[model samples]
Target: MQTTAKNALVSELRERIQHLEGGAVRSRTVLPFGVPAIDSVLPSGGLAYGALHEVAGGGSGTVDGAAAALFVAGIAARTKGKIVWCLTRPDLFFPALAQVGLRADRVVFVESDREEDVLANMLEALSYGGLGAVVGELVRLPMTASRRLQLAAEKTGTIGLAVRRWRRQTEAHDFGQPTASTTRWRVSVMPSEELPVPGVGRGRWLLELMRSRAGECAEFLVGACDDKGRIDISTRAGDRQDQTSRSVHSG
Candidate 1:
């Protein structure tokens, strides 16, 4: 009789949970990166749609800024529909974005004269609900502005990316401030792999999940996006012997 009662209780609880999760499941859509090591650290094993995320470089140099831009572009490349890129300047190179799978034809670039205009355009694009993703580049993003962006994305089920670039080292510290983004990431360019024959191999990056609302934050050493905009763990990310042992064990 006790076993029977326990089984009934379990069934009742499961039903209640399913009822509660029905609406949540629809709102919390995900886009999986398909990399086990990286996905394991993120909630739902992927990046969340209907949310706003922030990405920044490790430093204030132009190269550092480019790394952050390309990283966001790669994410946008994997999304469906058209991509809207809003920036204060038109200095981004199209070839670099195309190499990461964000083709020129699929992207619409909006140049704004001021930072406020960039943020406004980004929020408007995210609210449209039809675009695959919206990316905004700004030197300073206040907490209130980020919250507005987040709310807009949640309402429209669109993905919003904020690329923070600073001209001075002191201004870079502003990135550490609080924001309403669902996730905050810092990407730094790493040395590319050296081929035994002649040319360079794929680029690598130190991707740091500085803050995340849905899961534990972590760091990863990952290769740059391939032709299809898919990322893979770097060959030198971990100890080779340890990886071999793990592979053998799993096998």
Candidate 2:
């Protein structure tokens, strides 16, 4: 009787695995951000794959810029294949990204002179597919340009990330324009948790999920990615704030 029960359990496990691989479990492909508070707000309980997503700094400055970059790096670290990072700026610190889980070895940086060129490179990379993710840094992303990137990502099932960086506050306002991206997020640096020992604590961010295709907008105060590039919701810093405070109208 014991041997028969073990055989039945093994068969059930194998069938479950097959069902997952056959795409019968989830209709749309998604990568869980690993934070339940954030994931629950998304339509598929995670960030959708084969789509374009945008991230921007909360304001115009180095600190805000670093927060946005680290946020994207954390997402890239969780992807499956090689990462293609296209940027016009050469000031990205490798060690900082490493701390967030995106290793230097897995990234291939593509430099361009113009922001337009950076978008072009991202589109090309997304079209090629098989890449873990494609990231681009741009100051201005027009609606038409974003639509192209979205189509390319959809075609190849590759994740495309656009990191918006603006030198001027006026330029940052352009993010309010509509785009073809499936989701839009804004990352702002927050004070780290105070430790009893009086040393540095885990990094923290105010993550705003401003837009989603089918999910409601939400905000999360979350700890930064650990060594494994996994971010967790901070229980100490619960989701505090009204809808008006968290709502970001990215139309």
Candidate 3:
């Protein structure tokens, strides 16, 4: 049909634009999730390095946002070199980050009074390169701003993470808009894995891949925050199924 043809042309055009951005698809490094189920659906068989990725909590509450932030922490912990964390708030719990694998010694925190300052600092850190990753607590990631972030990452081979946290639920609507991020994710807290005895166990999360270029959307139920900050595949994953099909677009 004509509609399908139009869509194909649009897709091709986007690819061309991305290719011209100083990063071809094959030039970036890939970070595998280590779970076949999760990695299989990604276009690169893993998250691409030297790119910008978005992460937001499933809900507007602080708990949801914190979980999303911790997920990002775990990722940065696994990478090499130091991590630069730029944020508008000083409330990030260092002890919680340790529980997820990123220790204080490996992190450099940059505090800012404004969201725009935090984003500016993140862009600067990514441009510096040789760091593990640069993280920013963002309320809104405008398309133009995100493109700049992505370009900086691509040029420096650094990974950039925008952990979206908003003051109001209404502000969450902004996340629905498109960005130049290489990947977009939503993370929701789930029940902890059952333990052998009466005690707390490893946390669990329902991770949704909302948008990816040349990749299908997928949901993963996985155990969380190991000593090394990696979220392993939950044994319960087999019991669950994705509510949305692979063809689902941005949500």
Q: Go through the candidates in order and give the clash count of each.
A: 0, 0, 0
Per-candidate TM equals 0.84, 0.84, 0.85
Question: Which is better, 1 or 2, measured by lDDT?
Answer: 2
- Candidate order by lDDT, decreasing, is 3, 2, 1
Per-residue lDDT of 153 in model 1: 91
Q: Lowest lDDT 10-mer window, candidate 3?
A: 242-251
Off by over 4 Å in 1: 1-23, 59-64, 237-251
lDDT of 1 at 210: 79
Cα RMSDs, all models? 7.9, 9.2, 8.6
| Candidate maximizing TM-score | 3
**What is the Å distance of residue 161 in model 2 from its true position?**
0.3
Best by lDDT: 3
Instruction: Put down candidate 3 lDDT per residue, 1-251, tens digits, no spaces.
Output: 99999999999999889877656653347888787887877777888889999999985343338889999999898899999999987888888999999999999999999888998999999899999999999998999999999999988888899999988777888989989998999988888887779998788888888898777787888888776878877786444765334545543
Per residue, candidate 2 scores C-alpha lDDT tens digits across 1-251 of 99999999999999989876654333378999876667877878898888999999884343347888888999999998999999988889999999989999999999999998998899899999999999999888899999999888887888899998887677777889989999998988778877889799998887888898877777877888887788877656344644235544443
Per-residue lDDT over 1-251 for candidate 1, one digit per residue giving the tens place of the 0 to 100 score: 99999999999999989976863674578888888876766778889898999999874333348888988999999999999999987889989998989999999999989999999999999989888999999898899999999989987888999999876777888988898988888888877877778998888887777787857677777788876777877876342322112111100
Q: Model 3, which residues run further than 4 Å from truth?
A: 1-26, 60-64, 241-251
Greater-lDDT candidate between 2 and 3 = 3
**Residue pairs of candidate 2 with colliding backbone atoms:** none
